[model samples]
Target: MTTLTLRGLRTASRFQRVQPHPLLGLQSQFLVPQTPSFRYASTTSALPTRTPRTFPVNGPSTTLPAPLNVPARGENQSLVPYLYSVGKSYLAFYKTGVWNIYTNFKLSREVQRKIDAQNASTFSAAVVSASLTRSDLQLLVRNWHDIKRVPMFALVLLICGEFTPLVVIAISSIVPWTCRIPKQVESDRRKLEQRRSASFRELTTEPPTEAGVEKLAKTQLMHINKSLGLSFGMWDWVGGLPTGILRRKVSRRVEYLELDDGLIRKAGGIQHMELEEVKMALVERGVDVLSKGEAQLKGHLNAWLLSREKAPVEKLLLTRPSVWPVRMNAPEKV
Candidate 1:
């Protein structure tokens, strides 16, 4: 009985310790359902995700529109609207002036000094520019006359319409830019017509070339001085402005015009500019815009610009003998 029990125990132990299948230990490496397979990947992708840049260079274009000073107009546009605009313009002008004055006065001493200097420089530039151009000079004169009449005009308004009509009657070319009536415009047209009608049938002028610029400039200086029509014949040879004075003036004028030419050309040339601007340019260059057609005016302006464009020699024109007698330094003896 003991032997049989021991044999039975050994048999049971052998059955429990049976050998395992070869695929059981390598199940992960199988491709088939019942076979072993490789392990799944645990690492992320090799390439990185892309993002946009923080800042870019180009943005947008900035071309400007031309300014248009169009007047009020319609089937029933009346004098009231025009009057309102004039009042608005006057108020704006005064408001700007007062504001500028106030701001300038509030600045520190050093800042005020700088501002004053800047203002003086600007004033000088404006004066020189105005005097060099005819239309600008006319405008300057008109404003001056307007300024002189402003006090009387204010008084008339203060009197409660008592002298308003009388003041209006007295108002002619001396009227402010903001207060010009249709009659004034008509008067200007009439003046232009009369001037055109009375002038010479044909006019000619000598233009300076690159070859003989000095002589031409001198001749031009004398001619310009003569054209100025100063009282008592100040530009005539006998009682004329000294040649030195003429030279100085002409030289400065030429330099100013030359400096402005590039800017004007780049700003689409004088030919297509505002009528007043074109007139200003032509008047300064001795071209008659009056009674001329648009094409003719443009042609003259273009010719004027072309004539001066290549002549940087004008800068040294003052160094030459002006349109007057020059005592050649007695041919200094050797």
Candidate 2:
């Protein structure tokens, strides 16, 4: 019986080594299934588990997201909404009279300064001499049309109390205060138009000779120089107040020296002179002309005429070489 038991124990050990235990197989089937072997990789290390990321409460990521697909303020959108917003805000502050008070103070100070400057005498003397004559009154009447529309009540107040100097000053200070920025913008536009018109007229005038063309070129160069030197003045700063916060548009006007076909024809055709002759003339006048294609020769010449060089003229003259080959005399007949 002992020998038989020993043989049975050895057989059982062998059987355990060859096959998985019944309990392990049942657990695997119920809980975890056996994975199939892959031809490339049968075993792989398990990946690390990822933890949830945390961010600071006060960081920009926590802020409200920007409005996507919304058009920019100036991109052909109606301004009714913006105006309504401004009106709403203004109404909130209407009871404060802050704008009116500030305007009145500024105007009073400005008017006083003007009064003092014009008279250069005692305050009483200035007031006494500042009488509105019949012509002055008529001129004011004519100029009334120039002023922008004001409230009917404001107009009545201005007209009824025209005799009273204090009332006149008050009305003048308040009535046009709101329209000042628009008036200034209009004035600046007019000035720019005038300048452009004058330049155009000057350029259109026919120059008699090449020298005249050179003179015009110099004038244009000078104008460019002046424009480069220009900066935003006090008036520009004041006018910018109305729209500066709403938009960052700059009001600078850039003028270019553009010659029309008529003007070009008047100033002698580009092919009137030989390239060598033109180049020589420009060099003599201390103008640097870089040799380019014949197509760009006209532009170079125009630039040469317009350059404002302070250098003294050089005496260099360019001449084309003779194209004819050396002539050989016929061999003497013997």
Candidate 3:
């Protein structure tokens, strides 16, 4: 019986050990269903956070921004002494009648002394003289006839008449009329008629170039001898256009000019042109000769004439072709 009990106990222990191994194998199979074949990896590295620079709550920083490098106003350089001398001379001419009164003022010694004295930073004489000259407002008024061609009231009245005709008539009835000579009135009337009738005839009888000179000469009310002079002897010509109507008439004639110095016999013996024609030809040729790609040739021509420096017509054409037409409409300031 003792032997049987020992064998039974050995068998039970063996069975228990085998049973635990089978259960452990089953547990591992169940756990295998929960496990993943591929592990996930993070794509991005961790980034560090930064603190922004902050200003003090009390006040702004003493150091200026990069752009604020200009000098203070009081630190600027002083004006030149010769400039001050010029100012003194201009002041003397304008004020005190000193320039005219002191005839000896032009002498070198007196002039130099005044100029030197005037140049000082706090020159008392200059300051006093300038202040006094500026303050003396009475000297500013002058005789209108001495310098101005027409009275200020006449110009004002003319403008006023155009703008307010009723006011002009009312004022005219109150003021006494100044009588001008009938001959003078007739002369002015003839001049006005000539200006209004200054139309460009197609010159069926003669070319505009030829007819323009004769017409311009005959149209002049003031008789000027052709043999004695190259230019017309009109005082109005020297003084330039007197009225807007006259100016427009002159501009219209100038626009149609196409003649050269010689005779231009147009088709069917219609007209003949002469010297004014030649001048016109020069002006037209001047457009071709003076112009570049896109620029007005006349301005270039004038600039060349004034400065004697070459301006590029070729490069101008290449750069700006649209400005070429501007030459025709340009104002004749010269």
lDDT of 3 by residue, 1-334 (tens): 0111111111122222332222111121111222111100111222211122111110011110011111223444455554454444322222212111111111212222342455442222332444211111101111111112123334543454323223433233221111111233234334433432332121123212222222443323111111111123353356433344343333222322211011111111112212222222223222222223222333443332222112222112111223432333221222
- List, residue by residue over 25-111, the lDDT tens digit for candidate 1: 322111112311111111133221122211111000000011112345566768778766645443333322222222111211222
Among the numbered candidates, top lDDT falls to: 1
Q: Each model's C-alpha lDDT?
A: 0.36, 0.27, 0.23
C-alpha lDDT of residue 169 in model 1 = 42
Residue pairs in clash, model 2: none
My TM-score estimates for the predictions, one after another, are 0.36, 0.17, 0.15
Candidate 2 per-residue C-alpha lDDT over 103-196 given as tens digits, one digit per residue, 9 for 90 to 100: 2222222333444466552333332464211112111221232222234324544454322223433333333322222233234334443443
Q: Model 3 scores what on Cα lDDT?
A: 0.23
TM-score of 3: 0.15
Q: Candidate 2: which stretches are off by over 4 Å?
A: 1-83, 86-191, 194-196, 199-334
TM-score of 1: 0.36
Candidate 1 displacement at residue 154 in angstroms: 12
